[model samples]
Target: MSSVWHARCAGLMITSLALFAGTAWSATISHAAAPAAAHSAPAAAAAQPAAPTYQHTASYQAAEAKYNQIRALQVQAFDASECIRKKDCPSDESDMLRPLEQALVLKRALETAASAGDRDAAYFRAKVAAEESARFNEEADIYTGFQDPAYKRSAGLAYERAVRERDFAKNMLVAGAIDLHPWSCMLYADLNMAAQPGVNNRDAAFNAYYCAASGFADRGLKDLALKAYAGMLKTGHPQHPYVLDMHSRLLNVRPDNPWRKIEPSGLVRQPATTSKTSHH
Candidate 1:
């Protein structure tokens, strides 16, 4: 495999593995306890609803198994590529083909399961398609030495398909599923960033930020989540009010706000804009 291909595969694999843990966050809303009259305590307790439960179905389980298999093969391929690069262990290019082939088979299984209304399957299918698109684009870059329009066009078509698959999967998902697969939000964000900017881009960006921020918060990365929300608010998008409201609520609920102490100078800054005359 090419170096670019290896890097992309390794990066994505690490991210997926890190975020795929089965820990579930609370599905019910939490409220602060308040000092109440003794008589009202029992009535307040009775008013709370039971949290809903989620059980993975047989199809979802099967699809998950297949997805795991694909990930394992990808790891093997990535290892082989690294060994070949170092020339420390004998590795053949053919070793990488196994994972690519298995991934395609897994994609088909995921597609079938997704069509049957399996939300997890839909998510996995979208991920597979996105990976395939990345692979195609990287391969095209290598094969053409980054100069061939035809190859780029072919890769672009694959990207379009990946986007469609991602959207389909997103439509099938619920909030709980999104919490379980927070990486999906980041994946969607990447796709939107790559897309040509339009009216939808603003909403898509906000949704991605919101979902990812919630995911981070659920995982107890409150500072990271707060920073994301703050950045969203700074964008001055039409959704600024909503971002501000969320930030305010987060601070209200968590009094030990780290975001207040964070300085703009510590964050990454955008490159300074330049005029055409300055370039000369």
Candidate 2:
């Protein structure tokens, strides 16, 4: 009887231990599985990025199309203006008024784009305004140069009107320059020069070109800055000490400038180096 009781007690203890072990194992498995599920959830979410909606895509595509259309028109107007300027196509000047009319249209479009927050369009519009002003000024001169009294009288009035419009172009040029448009700054500098007859303001022209050169240099456009610097030299002011110093400084900064290198006269000379022989 005693042996049978001891055997029964041992069996009961073994069964209890097995039950406890099974419970502990199930808890461990549940805890590990929970962490894995939590980690996988964040990982899965992180793998995906937000995508553009249909409306965004449509709006972007529309803007791109409009921008491209305006660019094409601007290009066409630019080419036509070039042709008119060169007198390569007199017919264009007779009817379509290649530069002024087409440029005016482009100007308006560019203005609209600028108003809509397009900076490049504003710069382009400023350039067109400058071109229009120049063309008008030229036309005014041609008309005033007419030998006939009747033509001269009418053309003189036109010339005065053009001069007034040219003032507006100067304002546009200033606007573009303030916006840091390099080409506009150049045109502005040129317009302010005393090179044209009856317009003598050497001081103003020199200052404008100097400012442009400094701005371009600050923007890492050393080449363009060099051009503006050269323009200062072109102003009978080449002998000025300041001009000479600036030119020398720029040459030192850019020894291998492509534009300057292309000019055979501006080539820099290399100094000969002599080596000493050592006798042992």
The prediction achieving the highest lDDT against the true structure is 2
Model 2: worst 10 consecutive residues (lDDT sum): 52-61
Per-residue lDDT over 38-59 for candidate 2, one digit per residue giving the tens place of the 0 to 100 score = 8998899789887533232343
Off by over 4 Å in 1: 1-65, 75-98, 141-186, 196-200, 211-239, 252-280
* lDDT, residue 194, candidate 2: 19
lDDT of each: 0.63, 0.65
Clash tally, candidates in order: 0, 0
Model 2: residue 205 alpha-carbon error in angstroms = 1.9
Per-residue CA lDDT of model 1 for 128-177, tens digit only, reads 65665556555544555545787667666755655565455445443324
Q: What is the TM-score of each candidate against the true structure?
A: 0.46, 0.48
Deviating ranges (above 4 Å) for candidate 2: 1-105, 112-122, 178-181, 194-197, 236-245, 254-280
